[model samples]
Target: MRQAHRFGSATIWQRNYYDHIIRNERSLQPMRHYITHNSLTWADGQLHPCNPSKW
Candidate 1:
């Protein structure tokens, strides 16, 4: 964080994060897809300031 501030940059990570446990492959597959495609499927709103249209 200090280095980023010094370089006039910002970090994407927050101070806290959630941790989940995958007991088996079945549960892990969906989460993997969601995480990989979340940004690609973002909706047009305040949360997504770059592109207002869906891909």
Candidate 2:
């Protein structure tokens, strides 16, 4: 049966399949860049739903 989303859904979350530790700023910069870049290029990605969030 289909379930109604009474509380909405997750649009920016992922399963915690793994974990990492950032002991310093240098260790975290790359990850920050990755997320920011992804946001900037999300609309052009083939996996994006609307090529931005969802189609």
Q: Quick one: best lDDT, which candidate?
A: 1
Q: 11 in model 1: Cα distance from truth in Å?
A: 20
For model 2 the local lDDT of residue 17 reads 54
Residue-level lDDT of model 1, residues 1-55, one tens digit each, is: 6766999877657678777899999989999998878867665545565765532
lDDT of 2 by residue, 1-55 (tens): 1122544654444567567888899999998998899999977877766765443
Model 2, 11: alpha-carbon shift in Å?
Answer: 18
Query: How well does each candidate superpose onto the true structure, as a TM-score?
Result: 0.42, 0.52
Q: Which regions of candidate 1 fall more than 4 Å away from where they truly are?
A: 1-19, 43-45, 51-55
The ten-residue window of minimal lDDT in model 2 covers: 1-10
Judged by lDDT against the true structure, how good is candidate 2? 0.72
Best by the TM-score measure: 2
